[model samples]
Target: MRARTWRRIPPAARRLLAAASAVAAMALLAACGSDGDSASGGTAAVEPVTVGLASGGSRQDGSWTQAWYEGSQTAQAELGDTVKVTFVDETNSVDAYDKSAASFLSGGGDTWIFATAEVPQLVDKFAKQFPDSMVCGVEAPRESYAANICTLLPRFEQGTFLAGFLAGSMSETGHVGVVGAFDFPILTAELEGFVLGARYANPDIKISRTYIQSFSDPAKGRAAALAQMSQGADILFSGVDQATQGIYQAARTAPGTYVIPQYFDSWEQAPDVVLTSVIYNLQGVSQEMIRLAASGELANQHYEFDLKNDGVGKLAPFHELDSQVSDDVKSRLAEVEAQVISGEILVPGPDVLGTTGAGSKLDLATIKAE
Candidate 1:
């Protein structure tokens, strides 16, 4: 659950040259165990397998990094002494992240998780350099098929669509808005999905979208939310990080307004106005990756966590706001979820939605489910 300062090992001449198979490595570990007593029967020691994680953000970011931190703890709890999870946080720069990874490898760590975006290249680079070790890149743009590489892309749009549908159904002003952090492709896809879902639920609904260009600036997020609220948006969705607090704050002042946040369950932050959350389930996904690596069955390909996987792209419980959502709304939400998971409703990815925003030209008729 926590990252510690690991003793640095010089990487110049200490790099592991020979690649070892997982089976061979396991056998070597067993052989290194303390010998059993001859006079009295004694069990061989259980050699702990160490796994390292490198993240660009702090472990307590209350968002992405925090989820992975909890996941590591969960994996360790489940695997017990058989697996050891250690992490190095605040590796924000490329050089820092690479150095941390190299240090981990130099210290005999076979499996390392790169927890952030734009890491598929590094995953492939490290995987090729250390074929014996399993390398995982979280939130990677694409799949890496190298023998020991694991790339991940969580289908967050699915969950966002569900939340947007809820907002569309519940909005009294016939308008909903999204306050996004940036206009990146992934975030754009999520924002577009919300728009599509809202329109699906209520074709007459109006959407107001804004990009604050900052993830940690609460003032900017609040200002965007307030501006949308002034334009008669009764329900709002947040695609920002700590800035989401601003949306929550704005919701508090405007009675009957609701907010939906992404990444993790944030109902506790504003229980009064939080309708629900679009969760990526980073904790669950991370735990699965660690388990696979530990068992030596991790595949070399891109991993997608979607509605069908039951790994990510799910909505959190509606806690205190449960009574506000009608049974009909809940039923429709469930039906749409099944359709998306079954491929009947093919939610478009970012690539499919080119430069989307409020009032953007769209052929809604062409987006129907097959």
Candidate 2:
């Protein structure tokens, strides 16, 4: 998704707002001690810690980056006075990431990190350079570091499945569309789950899939969505971030066509057209990580959150289309959710250039029978 250009708010005004928000956040964090046990029965001493955040994009983009910001805010609220977040904006280069990490470390940040798998080398370099500082890389594994670095990834397939169910149930044309940022394993997992879910709900469901090759191109996303709709797709599910707003806009022109948003609830963008959202709860995960850090038990490992962990999942807020969804459909969806969380329903593993990854291939026949 090409990032939407903001009407330049004077740089001074922007800086002032950022400073003010940071001050307010710091105050809030100060009031909340690092008490992890208060929420989950893990009593630990409250400590004042300073953490830094690095983003590949702006916090206002309403996408993956915003989700990370939300998580930082939650950590600030729950950890009080111990957290400070500084984001690197429009990070499109490795040099930028390296500089951001170095700056954060030099500035005394207890934890310096970047979100996304695109900056593997930068993350690895920083992990080695600042071994004392905790480092977090979101959405991919930290292949080199073992002690001071950890990776956080979401079970995005879980949410995609729910979105597929919505599309399959609501699609009038029997065709649903998916817009992806890239053709990577992660994106493929989302597409696979969505296709599987749609097929599970309706055997004859047809899926139209496309990759924009970039995560910041709104025009591309909009055009792809329009093309799919033109080809008879009635529901659009996007794995791209801000570009999804373009998809929502495209759906509006089609009246009854619906869209499923990524990262956060986008119903406000098109109340009549947006079916529901497959949201990521980064705030919850960030808070948990901060608590673990405070307890000195933070480990370098891949942490995957799913419907079962309340880490990543779906939200079908009752909207204009609520009445159209049958009671039996809702009940069946609930059953599907339970089965997925309990491991009874397995989403297919990622396919590499059309080949399935490790794990038993999903039995499509059995899934549809359920």
Candidate 3:
């Protein structure tokens, strides 16, 4: 599978939007028909390539799973008729992941896309069970996984740092809030980075964090956002997945409040309220993995996509706030990008900060959030 030029469209954001329903509908039974010629131009037939993704959630969920599903679509298009993409949704649960992978592999689908963190838990077991199959985990670094099970994720904190900078710079109240779902190490990294950048921009920046624990509970997310807002937060960053939409809903009632979205370019969600988003190239990452898998070189690799590799996208365009952002701010963000890529700036992650806490179950200032 390879990537190509394609029009960028707004995401379906899980239950938050209806447009994504079609993406899931089309994907559930999506089949790629060959154009009768190999992309390689060989007179011989192209070998059949089947890629299966045991997604943790529905493709409609606008964040993690949607990115994987989009990759499937790209692979289908780029790989042409020689490839068939199969999807098994609702793989969040360990039982579901085990059962779904078993079912997909039993049907002779060997190359698999493990889009859930739970999939890593099944990697060694599944690799032994299926032996010849490749299990690729998303959402974290898989560099430490078993040889047969690989992983890939972006340095999400790099982008989160930029968001925090923008939030801190633009906040009239010098206070911002982050509404996060379940706390993963990556989420912790994002939180820590956000505060780091905010403080760099405004040393007096006060940070508040609220965790709702569940990724699907909008009411809880709204409550969390409101809690932070009541404490005087003017800028909000969401670390939660689809449930983050609820924070957007909460922001709607608060006039002059700004929002920063992650994972996707969600400007269409709130063009006026958005500061910008920390974007990811999910399609690109998926395509590269498939390409490697097709060539039998995907094992024992921990792939990371970030600002330097174009695997991660920087701050999205500030649509309605175009004029509001000073040119100086833009230039500083570019400098941050350069410094991060050049290793001149080392963003402190949870590993460096040494914290194992998360969600409402953990301590608030564990990550040095003020």
Q: Model 1 clash pairs?
A: none
lDDT, each prediction: 0.79, 0.72, 0.72
Which segments of candidate 3 are over 4 A away from where they belong?
1-46, 139-145, 348-350, 353-370
lDDT of 1 by residue, 1-370 (tens): 1222222434432343223355678787766652333223334565567788887667887777788888888998999888888878878677888888888877678799898764556777777777778888754345226677777777877778778888888889999998887676677778878887898789899999999988778999899999999999999999887888888999889999999988778898999999998888889887887887777677777777888875577889999999999999999999988888887877766556524663234566655664
Q: Which ten residues in a row are the worst by lDDT in model 3?
A: 1-10
For every model shown, what is its TM-score relative to the native structure? 0.79, 0.78, 0.79
> Tens digit of lDDT per residue, candidate 2, span 272-307?
877888876765666666666655566777776777
Instruction: Name every residue pair that clashes in candidate 3.
Output: 14-60, 14-62, 34-81, 207-370
lDDT of 1 at 362: 59
TM-score for model 2? 0.78
What's the lDDT for residue 197 in model 1?
A: 84
Better model by TM-score, 2 or 3?
3
